[model samples]
Target chain A: MSILEILSYIGTFILLINTIIYSISFSFKKEAYSFFCVYLLIMLIITLLTTYYNSQKVNNLFLSHYYFLSQFILLSLFYKYVFENKKNKLLINTTLILIIYFLVLQYAMDTTLFQIFNLTEVVVTSLPLIIYSIIFFYQNLNAKVKFIYINIGVFMYLLCSMLLFASGNLMIELDPLINKIVWIVNASLYIVFQILIFIEWRKNYYRKIPKSS
Target chain B: MEKELLQEDSQIIVIILIAIMILLLMAVALVVFFFFSRKKIIATELEKANLAISYQKELLYSTIETQEEERKRIAQDLHDAISAKLNVVSLSTHVLIDGTLDKEEQAQTLQHILSVTTHTLESSRRLAHNLLPPILENFGLQATVEELCDEFMSSKKVFVSYDINYEDSLSKANELHIFRIIQELLNNAVRHGAAEQITLNIQEYDKKLQILFTDNGRGFDIRSIDKKKGIGLKNIESRVDILNGALSYSSELGKGTTFTINITKT
Candidate 1:
């Protein structure tokens, strides 16, 4: 496999390990943890299916479609759970409306089922996530250490990924070499997001245990 | 195909550049927001700390002032009531011991000594009572305040009149604090206000005691009363605080002063 392919596999592995560690650290009953676990689980499934499809030399655009749909649904629920204490009705309602709009666009738009990339869908889905991350960061500017790290991680990941994916389809059509480099960078950022989440989980775990002398 | 690919490449570059610019703007905005927010938080905390320290200093100064005032008053009382009367008794004894008078004259001298000694004992008792009134300990706050007002009236200090309607008695410590507050207010009215017809009203409602002290005196401007100079008012304020009470003072030049205190029952 190419170095880029290896890096993508490493990103998937990091995400899977992060989810496992988080699950061990916190109970699944909490809304925030439960929603996050669902999100990570979906991503892991998609990653595994994509790897399988690539080895089999079969198309995986259907899985990509599922990936976008699940992300829109699960990430919205995740943030809503995170901000449950804030009682922000506007954020919750906006997220719901955005999800509905994304679904309608995906069904109504004339797009190929086996298409290699869908830049419009990616941008439409990512823009709201970026806005939500920024809002979370602003609201929790003075929050605990773990929360600050989480907000930064979310904000940076969504922001950089949005930029990369917004120009990704054009890069592929223009130059395959540059497209590969952008994908590599995107994979690295995904790994960074996983590491940040792992750190936040570790902090929360230690916070629950009583310190010994 | 080559031309279209070149155009797409340029489009991608433009989009990437725009995204980078937006990201830099957001970073700058976030840094400025955090910087100002931290500065504001620090300033607020510092202001709160300063206010607490100033309050503590005021309390300490008032305590020291009350102590000094009490000591001076005690010294003056002893000199005027006990020392002078004792001097008279001593001189009368000297005359009786001269041994030059007839039996009737000596008997008259003995009677004179008895009168002087009795008067000296009464003066000593009055001085001790002024220090800590026994009436406050035995009778409740109402009776003690009534006795205080009657004494001021008999002395013709300022024609003091009081009406007390307190139903429940307070603890000894609380009553003593209330008594001292009333005494300080009356003293201020008599010495500073310098008018007649002082009225005191004490009532209890909903487990809270309220006292209204008003005087038809030549009142001075409340703003002109410096807290540092008026130790008596500070002492009264401290006593009111000890009772978990709130005190309000209102006065206008030549319009008479009024003091209102509301205390919660323990």
Candidate 2:
């Protein structure tokens, strides 16, 4: 297996472990963490499908689009869950508007699913998500909220991935080698993001244990 | 065509390198900003914690000093009031026991011992009453304060006028604290302020007990007075704190002094 494939497997393994841990720890309390678990599960499945399709020599760009779309939707849902109790109408409305915009743009522009990565789609979706993450940071800076760590994780991941995909299509057209390298960096950042989520889950697990006892 | 493609590729590499440099710089700047802000927040929190600790220490010191002063006062009262009179009684009894005198002389000596014993008993009761007045325990804060005012009035030392408008009484523990605070204030006015006339008013307003103590005396500078140096004021302060009350005092040199205290009802 190639180095990229190995890295991909590692990312998949981390996601799988994090999902299982979250499931076991918060099985009965699903409302609080269901969207996050779904995000993790979808990421794991996408990773596995991409790896299998690569080995079988089939075109899997559709899976890549699916990966981005599913992540945008599920991560948005997760954030909505995180801020469910907050009484800020503006933030909720803006998030809803951004999601609608993303869907409309993807449906209108993404005609050929097997074609190159939809750089426009990635940029459009990521910009608002990045803004939302920043809003989350600002809103919770002095608030007595427990989801600060997860918010930071989400913010950093969006920031790095936004920049990575902003220049993605240009690099793909220019040089496959550089494209591969950038994708590797993206994968590493995603793995780090997964680990951050795992840390948040582990914190919740330990926090609940004492209460349960 | 091949040469042109190579040139184009080199230019793209330069651009990518610049982009990567910008991103790296941004990342470094962000990390630095996060750490710097975090350090500032931690420092502010540490300062607040330190301030709270220092205030608590000052309060503890004041409490300890007040206890020591109380012990000294009790010891002095016992020595001067009860102990000295008891000694005189003992000496008289000893003379009676010697049996060197006539019957009339022995009878006179026994009479003298009885008189001394009666005086000593009164002194002991007075001291105990001063320490923790039974009037305060049974009759409540109003009667206790009124009795105290009457005692001062009858003493002809200082003319004290007081008004008690409070209808409800406090818990026993809180009543004791309030009584001590008033006693300390009165003592300070008489001893330190050297006041000839004093007015004390206590009333209940808006779920709070407001106490106003005013004295017309040779008042000293409120700013110049060291709170810790005068155990009387410090004792009052400690009691006010125990009662969860707020106290403020204003004094003008050679004019007068007024102390106001407001305690929230429990």
Candidate 3:
């Protein structure tokens, strides 16, 4: 196989492994915070499937659906977990309802309206969700060490996604160096978030010292 | 389809390399952590074992000396009290048997001799039993505890009761240590507390064994007693410490006193 094909396969495999580990961690203790783990696991699985389909050269409407839906799902899951739980039930519920509404709108809007606006509203609205996650990280100081690492990762992801979107909108062909930076950031954020969250979850769950001890 | 997708973006190869590097970092961190923690755990266990061995040696020396001293005291008590009394009664018996006397006078002398002989016998038996209850050496802790309760009940002085709920067979050394602890507590209750009622309980659950002793007595102020009666309490505390157990005391003046020790079976 060519280097590109080999790389695509390796990336897809890593994504699958990350999903499996994330799924296991999410299911281990069934804590309220475990919602984040489940969300990450789902995102990883969808990412894996999309990458595999893209690598296999099945570029079609399904691939586009997979691409947008996974991103939307991931962003929604992230926000819900960051600020949900009993303490912020009102915030959590409103955010969740809005997420579901936007997701349904993406799929159910009139063909003419969709053609006119395309996915512009969906993409634009996601910026605030991502920013809110960063804000939530700042607000939850007890979640500092864990959230700081995640904040750096999510910032990199947001930055790259925005740059890619802006570049696409302008119909500008960016230099290879910019492409390389985006690629590195995207891949590192994916891998780093998986590892960091896994470690944080393990620390919160399995490594607890009993009161007796 | 394949051609169009490949032509679109060829940067994914860089992403793959970056993922591999992150995985490598995590694996390295995990291995280092495992080795570091494993080494520390082993060193800690080693230190603990060494400390326990040294503590055991100190206990052994102290216990042996205490036993020797106890044996000497018993020997002196026998010689001074019971033996001297018995020797005097024996000489009196010989004098009374040899004397030529009338019937009424002979009967009076014989009655006196009989009373003295019986008293000496009773004193010797009581002293021997106090030194080491034969029941304890023969039938183990349970029978001895029951014997103690029976003795208390018969005397009608202290209302003492005992219950044993141990399922596992104890090693001889363990049983002996537990027996001595109970013996000492009872002595303390009788001598100091002026206790009217006392209870001893032994129970085992899961991997733990517990012994509880409670007494209804004119209990002393723990803070005040602790200052003066330090040695007795210290001995109890150290023995429980050696067993890697916990010992707790709850007492109130005019209310009651209770001592409980919980230890691991293994």
Candidate 4:
């Protein structure tokens, strides 16, 4: 296989291993572990799709469904982890229904369901994140390094996703160099945010033990 | 398409500005809430502490008053009964020794003086015992408790048993306090409980000591044991508290009464 394929597979394997560890750690009720698992699942799916697309398997509808569905699941899970709520059931169900409705639409579009995919992609990529911005707004005067990290990361992801979507998958016309840069930067921010989420979880978990001893 | 992108960018900027405004308002409100509530909480806690301190002061004052009143009563009793009798005996003895009289009359007078002297001595001994038992001061908790039990048993027909796991070598003050507590409890058992069989046990474990007393008697309603009326029990409780110890009692009518005290020593 090519070097890029080897790197994608290796990344997928690493993410899969992280997913397993996180799934096991979730048994202990660690939010970080669950968040880690969700992120790893997203990354693995993204890498798998990229690998398939490179291998000339772009026409497969199964790959298209797998890609959007994984993103939907990953986004919802990440949203729930950061902001705990019983009321989120409504939000989650609505988002899932929207994804399914669009997944069926992708079949008719015949161009690999890119537009309907964008609908889920844009919202999942932005709205909940902007909802998180509410916290920063409320905490206007407070110093929050984590909030800073999250806001920057979300902004990066939003800019990159928007650029990618606007180009209509025509990388050469939209500047393929910019697409590569956006991809690398967004992925790096995602990895950093994942690490930060894990660190926050560990801090809270350790806090649960009594300090008196 | 360009217009739509520009509109979206403007909307995003507006949303960010709105979010910043909202969070800023929330933070200010939170600080205000904390500032007011902290003072309220502190004020409430201070009020509680003051109230408790006032109640404790009232209790201590009443205890001192009760002790003084008891001392006054004992002093009056001694002067009225024992002292008067002693004066009479002294006059009679003086008359017998100084005046001439028949041998038989003199002998009867001497017998009368001896009986009066004996009764006066008994009354004086009882008075001293009420103040502080001599046996407890001389021999310690075990000997004093045993002597008290024997004395009460002989008079009241109450069977008493004393058991010790380890001999206590405590300070004089501690020994005195423990003795007083035991004495009051025993008196209550005999007077109110009408107890027939009483058992007292002293045991030492680790760095603490325990005193357990059980009586098979016609116990009273434990629920109705008012501190105002049950002065003896209250005194025992206060002593336990002062020692930083624990006291527990359980009793049921016609069943029995059990009192346990656990004291940790330095």
TM-score of chain B of each: 0.85, 0.89, 0.64, 0.82
**Cα deviation in Å at residue B61, candidate 4?**
4.0
Error of 4 at B120 (Å): 1.5
Candidate 3 lDDT by residue in tens digits, B1-266: 85554445444534534554564555345435544655666677788999999867766666676677788988898887778877777776777778877778778767877787788778788788876777767788787777766776687778887888864367766776677677778767877788879998998888898999999987778888765553456567767876778998989998889999999878
lDDT minimum window of 10 residues, candidate 2 chain A: A139-148
Which residue pairs show backbone clashes in model 3?
A: none
Residue pairs whose backbone atoms clash in candidate 2:
none
Candidate scoring better on TM-score of 1 and 2? 2
Could you tell me which residue pairs clash in candidate 1?
Answer: none
Best by TM-score: 2
- Residue-wise C-alpha lDDT for candidate 1, range A1-213, written one tens digit per residue: 887898888888888887776665455667766777788888898999998997899876667667766876777777777774565646666767876786676667765623755676676676776677666755655443334455556667777777776665566566665457667767877787888777877777646644567
Badly placed stretches (over 4 Å) of model 4 are A1-213, B1-16, B90-107, B226-229
How are the candidates ranked when ordered by TM-score, highest leading? Answer: 2, 1, 4, 3
- Write candidate 3's Cα lDDT for A1-213 as tens digits: 544445545555565664555455454454434555555656666666666766688743344344544555555555555555554545545656786686568558554433222355436545655556545544543322344444444544554454444333222243454355444544554565555555554555445433453
* Model 2 docking category: incorrect
Instruction: For candidate 4, write residues B115-215 as lDDT tens digits.
Output: 98898888888888878888776777788878888888889668888886656657778888888888888888888888889999989888888999999
What are the per-residue Cα lDDT tens digits for candidate 2 across A24-143?
655535553787778778888888888898789987777867777777777676667666556543565576677668667666776673376777667666666666666665555433
Choose 2 or 3, whichever is better by TM-score.
2
lDDT of each: 0.76, 0.76, 0.62, 0.64
Q: What C-alpha RMSD does candidate 3 show over the true interface residues after superposing them?
A: 10.5
